[model samples]
Target: MKNDDYSDVVMAALHVLEESGSLPNIERENKCEKRSDKYREEGNIAFKVGDVNRVLEFYNRALMFAPKNSRAIQLAYSNRSAILFKMGQFRACLIDVETCCKLGCPTDIESKLIKRKNEATVRSEMENLSANLLTGYFKDCFKFDFKSNTPIRCASSDIEVMKGDAFKVVAAKDIKVGTPLALEDSFVSSNSEKNVPFSCHYCHKMSEPDTM
Candidate 1:
């Protein structure tokens, strides 16, 4: 229903209840919490069947009706975090897990929330690192040279390789097909000659300057 229509319907119901003096004595918060629990139960059923979209829909409805700072609201956020994690939305999952912790999650579930938050943090960091490595800036700054024992060789001249893009590995010399390329610890590792630590010497995890 439209917002205006729903408001009208609620007003009409209030008027009827007032006239008949039949309105229940329950508090609005209690009623909303009960309704939210009903939706949460439905969402749990959807989760069991691996229906991601349906679970999200039902959980969202539960959140809409859950009272602020209530257990129901905390539970909704916690449940949604799991779904986000499964969908590979690590940042969002971390946010939800943090919210659940702030809302004082039950002792039984607090440990689980902490573990989920840690996992999301690690995944988010790895994703950010991959993106940074794929950027043109990082590619221009670092040069990847294969060592003498390396199976695959860098054909920078023969191949028109673009910066910040994935390129096919070509052997320096003709070899049989399906040859395994050993990329582990084969590069000549070196730190910047400058007196400053511009980036990590190994993983290239950058750190902000003290001036910042």
Candidate 2:
């Protein structure tokens, strides 16, 4: 009920309990159970709407009311992990997954299987090195070319190639489809005779700077 709904009768009952020092005597467990249920309900609603962060917040509040509440812990960790994973923060996802596991959540076989599937996907993504394969902000890959059989080092030049399409390169590289690259701290020099090597940022193949 809203605060204003506590009419004189409600206040009188509270005052009576206060004077009698019986407020604390009421079972704290019952009060917490009620609040926990309310918070969990709100949290579930947030989860259904894809507001994962807000869902975690509500579940955390429920946990404060019932620290050992299994559902609260499970929902908090699972939702937080999923959001973090989607945001391409796999490192953070790992931590949340561990916490969820340690909290005695996923007691049932189906729940455990679901958690394992999510964990596997995140883990596989974390191990991949290709910038295009990587989701989130890091996936904005630049293009470059490298010499064949050499490592396609990250470069700042704009090089674009369709998948499986090979461009004539001044050099060649051995990197594959999933190499990670960034434009930060990269340089493009105007020197003609320096013979700097470049790589296709998309395919990570080797090429020369002058030819591109």
The best candidate in terms of TM-score: 1
Query: Listing every candidate in turn, what is its Cα RMSD in Å to the true structure after a full C-alpha superposition?
Result: 18.2, 21.0
Error in Å for residue 110 of model 1: 0.6
**Cα displacement (Å) at residue 188, model 1:** 45
TM-score of each: 0.50, 0.36
lDDT of 2 by residue, 68-182 (tens): 6456555556655665555444555566666677776666643653665577566756566454456545444434333323233344122333335665433124545565333
Q: Give the TM-score of candidate 2.
A: 0.36
- lDDT score at residue 87, model 1, on the 0-100 scale: 63
Q: Which stretches of candidate 1 lie over 4 Å from their true place?
A: 1-31, 137-212
| Candidate 2 worst ten-residue window by lDDT | 189-198
